[model samples]
Target: MMREILYRLKDRYHFGTPTFQRDDLCFVTVKRDELRAILTELRDVEGFTHLTLLTAVDWLEERLFQLTYLINNREANLTLGLRVMLEREDEPGATTGDTIHDLWPTAATYQRELNEMFGINFPGSPRVDEEFILEGWTDLPPYRRDFDSLAYSQQTYNDLPGRKTHDPRDHMKKALYPTYLKEAE
Candidate 1:
């Protein structure tokens, strides 16, 4: 069934080869320009009505960001993941994606979070420029591979009073097998 749908749409849209991960799940890379139209057709014609998720993956090495839109057909128990690749830009707000909030209202929330976390802007998305999770965050987006989390933590936070750190292995050995080390020695 999935193959038939792909075959029908292959001529109309320029998409990459379909990769079937499972019997009910498939993934395909779709061009950025055709994403909105393809999504509309899938929802209206292919029965992929539910937008399960909209997420982004930062591929820093490749200098690209992969945006995946997973849609589901509840009646057919089929899931199709459409992936769109966007060039990763160093400057915040440079890398942008088309807004699909009109197709699925829930997409606005995901786009907002992506903009805040991954620095992938979705122009015209509702409140996308506003903070979603991070408040007053002027530093690099936390989810980006280039973001230095350790440096940020060290600079932003101070050690708590009387805070003691322990090695997990040693602590576990002492707690669970106190005599095992002595016997081995």
Candidate 2:
């Protein structure tokens, strides 16, 4: 019965049904626009009251990121994945995110983090322009694979100002410390 309701949105929405599940509650994937509708149905009709988690995965090599919403059916107390596959674009201006904050109040913070860390824009989400992580970042997002965390560290950070870049292992060598050669002695 619930599946039939969601099937109606098939043509109107773009989402993927996860192949794996362990319960009676069907896991149907729905688009961001349809997500509002589907989540409304779950809360008002099917009784999915808990939002377990919101997460994003970087597919930098593939030029995309996978966003996942873990929803639990309160009536049946079953968990299912609502996944959205977003293709990353070279043009940051073209990369826009969806807002699901209305469905879950807690989602606002998660959306903000995603925005700052990934440089994706979530339309209609409040305070997304505010920074929660990566203070004062001026370049491309640091989380993306192409961003180069090591290079950013080199450019933005200095190794204790003047401390020699010595390998700790060198200190343990017999030539450097006779006490370190106790085993060989």
Task: State the lDDT of candidate 1 residue by residue for 1-185, as single tens digits.
Answer: 88888999999999898999997999999999999999999999999999999999999999999999999999999999999999999987899999999999999999999999999999999999987799999999999999999899999999999999899998999899979988988
Residue 31's lDDT in candidate 1: 97
Cα lDDT listed for each candidate: 0.95, 0.72
Worst 10 residues of 2 by lDDT: 18-27
Error of 2 at 61 (Å): 3.0
Best by lDDT: 1
lDDT of 2: 0.72
Q: How do the residues 51-106 of candidate 2 rate in per-residue lDDT, one tens digit apiece? A: 87777777878888777778777666566677776878875535676788888888
Cα-based TM-score, every candidate = 0.89, 0.70
Which stretches of model 1 miss by more than 4 angstroms? 167-185
* 103 Cα displacement, candidate 1 (Å): 0.6
Root-mean-square deviation (CA) per prediction = 2.4, 6.2
